[model samples]
Target: MIAYLIGNIKDKYEDFVILETNGIGYEIFIPFPFDENYIKIYIFEHIKEDCYDLYGFLTFKDKEIFKKLISINGVGPRTACQMIKTYGIDQLINYIILEDTKSLSQIIGIGPKISKRIVLELKDIFLKKYSQNIYSTYKYDAVLALMALGYSKLDSQNSVNNIFLPNDTTEDIIKKALQILAQKV
Candidate 1:
């Protein structure tokens, strides 16, 4: 399997880009638009009986999320790409964690059923994978405090994740996260 590709962009299209590497061009469908002349993309190759396609992501996290999304029934690669392109990885995760099916259903191709399925299937997976760190308890409390202060779950989690220190208490994390959030405004 081709894991990744580092190349110069040869052309840009609505959903895909032509990347040239080693005197070869690869047409890769991307989740979002990129303006860089060169890039390193984590790739997911899809093979069918008579077709082969490549999906490219800017980060390994994005590629992993895409894989998870496509694993759900009724969620195709294109639908997964659209969801990511529309809501972004962080906000999408937030929506899933919160079980905000209405928000997810706002996407072009995602209906209520698929949105609910996405949330139901991925919520535990995300929480387990992302929140099982040594400081998970403290981090979770800090994130809840930030959310109570009216910050978005995405912003709260992001601040907490960035500002957490090994020795800090939940209150310390909250204070540091507030400082980080204040700097953004």
Candidate 2:
């Protein structure tokens, strides 16, 4: 029932952190590394027959993604956390929407089959918002231009992934993508 926590981190482990609040130390499993000694984190508590665990995230988006992932038949909290840790929220959503199972399967415990299943199950639910916002108008236009220039979808995607910064225009993205593609050639 612990929904959130704001405390000083007393210790850190490879897969978890010990957060002390009001003199009580609570062990919270985390998906990624955190260097801060003080943190305010959202939490998800999973209680089962022999296990009661708390998983923490710095953002609500991550918590929601974790919840969605663990709801899948073959995915558990740990697996879901690993997924977020590996690809991060933005890249993971893009991979799912694009049905790029090869990249998705690159994570340690994920295989081709699971990656496909993840895409099949979550793409429709998340694709629209992510596609519209994350890609942005100019970046999307740049991808289309790359496609028109004969780049394969995957090549174009890799060329421009997260390459746009604030205020970058279509021309800027196209230039960057071409530069990346040229380096690969």
Candidate 3:
């Protein structure tokens, strides 16, 4: 198994990113937190029925958490990514600690039944490695904007909270959330 890859970013696509190390380009699954600091990443490869998928995480803890997430009965990589995208690792940790299955289900692709299962199975694993410092600094102003525009807090939270990779700042979050929210009106 490949442990990790440290390289320069050769190119980035919409879903996958190409990292060049020693003249080889490794395309890894693009996590939302892949930014300037994540050009070099540790990867976990999962062999499936028809394909091998490489999931990337900037930290070993994150990779471990990802592994635990996918280990849930029905939680797949996509759902795990969706979970991280929506509430991030801290909120996920918080939710797990609080047993907030409702919040977990709010993540795209994670239903209540599956979320309850996740809370039951993986909560202990994630809380042990959860980092509050990183996610505490994480702030999203977009949700506030959506709330200001008369959208429900949960809706706004879910909308701006579910942005894809290429992690944006509070300002960027607001801009993109507005663009997405505009589609509704």
Best by lDDT: 1
Candidate 2 lDDT score relative to the true structure = 0.84
lDDT by residue for model 1 over 72-117, one digit each (tens)? 9989899999999997887777677768899999987789999999
Locate the minimum summed-lDDT window of 10 residues in model 3: 131-140
What are the root-mean-square deviations of the candidates from the true structure over C-alphas?
A: 6.6, 7.4, 10.8
Question: With candidate 2 superimposed using the best TM-score fit, by how many Å does residue 124's alpha carbon deviate from the native?
Answer: 1.1
Error of 3 at 71 (Å): 0.5
* Lowest lDDT 10-residue stretch of candidate 1: 129-138
* Candidate number that wins on TM-score, 1 or 2: 2
Write model 3 residue lDDT over 1-185, tens digit each, in one string. Answer: 99999888777766667888889878778566555733668888878899888777777867777778888888888778777767776667767765789888887778889888888887666556553422332334456666887878876776666763344556676677777777877
Clashing pairs in 2: none
Highest TM-score: which candidate? 2
Instruction: Point out where model 3 deviates above 4 Å.
Output: 127-185
lDDT (tens digit, per residue) of candidate 2 on 1-185: 78799999998998899999999999999997778999998999999999999999998888888898887777889888888888787777877776889988887777888888888998888875566544565577789999999998888877887577756777988999899998888
How do all the candidates rank in terms of TM-score, highest first? 2, 1, 3
- Alpha-carbon shift of residue 72 in model 3 (angstroms): 0.3
Per-model TM-score on C-alpha atoms: 0.71, 0.73, 0.65
